[model samples]
Target: MVTLLTGLCCALAMAPKWALPKILAAQDASTESLGQAPADDPRLAAVRRTMEPFGPIESIRVPGGDTTESLVVGHPGHRAELEVLARELPGATAAITELWGPDWAQSALVVIAATPSEFAALVRVGAEMPTEVAAASVADPFVRGNEPTGQRVVFSPDAGRRLSADGLGTLLRHELTHIAARAETADGAPQWMLEGFAEYAAHRGRGHRFAEIAPTVNAALRTGTLPEDLPPDTAFTGGSAVASYEQAWSASTFVAEKYDEHRLVELYRRLAAQRQDAASEDRVLREVLGIGRADFVADWRGWLSAQAV
Candidate 1:
């Protein structure tokens, strides 16, 4: 979630507009089942054709601590790295379930493309994806109202090489939080709340202080350019994207510090569920937090100042 591709993935969750390419039927099932499935084994090829257009080189079932849930990894190579990720699944899932509850899907599918082009093909975001994005949690293409047919976290091939173990863990947890909350997530939900909440959950109990996690915002505050409001969606895609991310994370942190964590969750649900209209949004603000939008912004600004100092 630390790159520009995050916005594109978030947009996909709100409106699943892309179409997946259709796969052709396998000609012979018995023939495909002949031997140890090679990279291009007809059986693997057939399965890939049916499930994914890019045809991942290989996939394996990773067992989770809970018998009911599992993680599936599709990768072109770097089996070692995939194994490392597999080991981290239980911890990540535990962190998310601890806060969001256990009502989400029983399985997670992770795709690790061998190259950027392959990653783009899997996610289908095309030219809009930035090279810097390490990973994304995308809603299933077949999602219907209130029910996501499936969800997966897709990792750029470079992610395995680019990110350290801790960095990778944080990235996975962040994306997983998105998947857990995707069903309730609204397209029109305030970007700050959307991204901020995810960041907050991702960093929970990681012992990162506010100033350390949000140095950009701290710098901005020290320069006397106090951000008066939540960042617009444009900020997520613009040059100030990193700072925008920090601002959002700080805002969510502020909410949790001043109010209760459950209130933060309620705020997200109410705002995300309401129509994307000013009047309805304002009503939700007053009803849920007992404050108007202006007052909330002022309060957030005050919190930012205090944190920066």
Candidate 2:
């Protein structure tokens, strides 16, 4: 999930949010297996070295259910915050499991950056971290082929400062959903659907009203200019990026409501497995949803209008 850096000039505003895309330079398969390594292992020394410039690093192992394990790292001073997130991870993992099932890795890692620079450095997104981005999940794709290695969730310093506990919980669930679906996600998958599916899982049972969360799209629908297609990649990095996320979420929500959650997951698998483009997208729409792209758009627009504030 990419978020545009806020307060940037028009040219720099297009920088993408750092995330684990479907393709990345894979790390050595033997570098360090996740969840199995001890916090004091020599390999983790490198992680500590990388974070040393920021503050004293601390690590904790939080036991998950029988299927998953969790570890969290943060500055010594932020122990309270890290503990809070540690408590949230199990519930987030359970939620994703219920939505997509337990086909993902057996372990999860979370990092809490003490500063914005630390956040940027951990995610390897360069020196200039976007002010608006709250957190990112990253992993090496090449080490395990389609599977991820060294997967971890990194949070911007502002995240803990600004978000309520519940808000942070929702965000963690969103990134965890990405982690669970990473292997199945294709480098060429539709960004809209990817974000939409994650958002659907993140917001499920959160009790947020549609009008409260989708004011931008709702306003557009009231003006009768419904979006004609899924959100383009460009929509995720520059102006209206947040609105694009909402639109994507609304699209996935519509699917879950109109059909069923299982069908939505099936659509994701079908699209993720195929080579996606404008043409393949149309074919996939017909093949999976039994409708043409035009009809899908019409139906989605109608649903949007119905939910408009």
Candidate 3:
């Protein structure tokens, strides 16, 4: 079981959709050990010093089997710690061996190294975001530089390997929706709509969780705070965080249910293409849905309320 960490961007927070091609390298079957033991080298000492700031140092254990010494930086936020590690380790080839996160706690990132030199280098370089914008951020952050790491899938290891088949498809559908929506422009997008669209894409034609209307309606009924409408700038914080996602998913679903699928795609395409424009989303929404964002919000809220009762 992998421990997920905080600071790592989830679907709600990442600004762009990143995809990478998988790489595969030919291996020498007889070359059993992938790691070389460190020679009490001064370089390893230097690398450790660089990584000291992120969190508590529980232990820096060497990797078992053919793997090199592994650095397990405990309690550090995944994004910051990994970034720090990347900066300290400028290795020849570094691979993410495993990543796990608790539902409500920070995540753990495990990396594998083939040699002391490689391990030292990886820890040095892990702190920086990839130079390539395309490799920026994802659920999985492993990419083998410009070279292919391995290829069961077209995307980088970050994308293609993190989830089970169904989960991968769901995540892909959500990410692809961002591509369609162009929500990742300089102007940015409202979180509710952004996540809502992705959620709709992920669960399209499937029986609804909120649509059974049990969870949301019951919550709303209990709180007397069921939202009739949502604002655009919804974020992943506070009570609104979870509620907003539920509302957005349901709202987008309502739009899909009433409108054509191709229309939604066109709406996203138009919005994405005009990402630089300040008014692009509204313009696209008006043109595609024959309604403004405000009107659409009202309608969706009304639809949600009707479903609840």
Candidate 4:
């Protein structure tokens, strides 16, 4: 049986709307051997060094078409979680590749933390990692036109306890989407495009109903409280986080519907390359989607209204 998992983003946290196109069936916990650890690869050794301080570690290698994609790592106590992530990694990568294309490294080091300290270390958050985040994608400082290095998705220790197999797959795809798109995504880019694009990728082609995915927005729509504009970056944190995510996803889905998936991606590329204010967003909207910011927001609100009933 599949269950919903609730892992909200702390800062860059992807709230719990993540679901996926592919899901692995229940498996023997021991059957997660996706591949053998390939020789003395430097990346693998580096990861081991980082994780070993927390405790003795174990891993499963996820093979790609020719080379391989990732290694799922965690403590023996969390073997079951590692196994599920290992099994889910391939399909998640495939989904990201399908959407973002085959340009990225297509590989990662997935770590399941043994404790909060371990989680903090893995994601390099110092101490006291944000408890709201279920999983997050991290990478070394990416240089323009260079493949990203040290890219990994670190899962909180409680991820396994909180997320089901299906949830694991969706969250994996969500974080992997961030890893895949990281290079194109500028730090100060609009939050609607950055997080919304990732949220859109996570749910695309997964047969999720609009209301099902954006229940918070649906609730607001029912009360004649449609969003006045795209969720501002400020909306992504603190009290309104869940609602903000729903609205962001809703705005992105509207783009996909009015234009097409390809244009939606194009829009993401255009808008995510820099910080956006009203005028800059208008320029990008006219360039990519051919609608100005006001029209885009108007159309999105209309789209949100249609989904309410």
Give one digit per residue, the lDDT tens place, for model 1 in 1-309.
332223235311110011112112223322123222345533234225434655445555554556744443555455655655666667788888877778786456666666667666656564535766767776544346567654677777766666555555666777888788777776666677778888888778776667666777887888888986778767876567778878888878887888878888888778766335556656877988888878888899988888774
- The alpha-carbon deviation from the true structure for residue 41 of candidate 1, after best TM-score superposition, in angstroms, is 15
For candidate 2, report its TM-score: 0.84
How big is the RMSD of model 2? 8.6
- Give the per-residue lDDT digits (tens) of candidate 2, residues 126-224: 675667777787766446566666667777775665665666666788788877887777665776787788778877987867865566777787787
Q: How accurate is candidate 1 locally (lDDT)?
A: 0.64
Candidate 3 residue-wise lDDT, 1-309, digit = tens: 000111122242221112122212223311123233243633334334534543333223323323333332222222232222322221201211111011111112233222233333333334332211111112222254322111110112232223223333344344333332222222343455556666666555433345332354445845555575554453445444545666767766677777866675455445534232335555677889998867876787666666653
TM values, all candidates: 0.79, 0.84, 0.43, 0.88
Indicate the residue-level lDDT of 71 in model 1: 43
Candidate order by TM-score, highest to lowest?
4, 2, 1, 3
Question: Candidate 1 deviates by what RMSD?
Answer: 9.3
The TM-score between candidate 4 and the true structure equals 0.88
Please give the CA lDDT of all the candidate structures.
Answer: 0.64, 0.70, 0.38, 0.74
- On lDDT, who's better, 3 or 4? 4
Ranking by lDDT: 4, 2, 1, 3
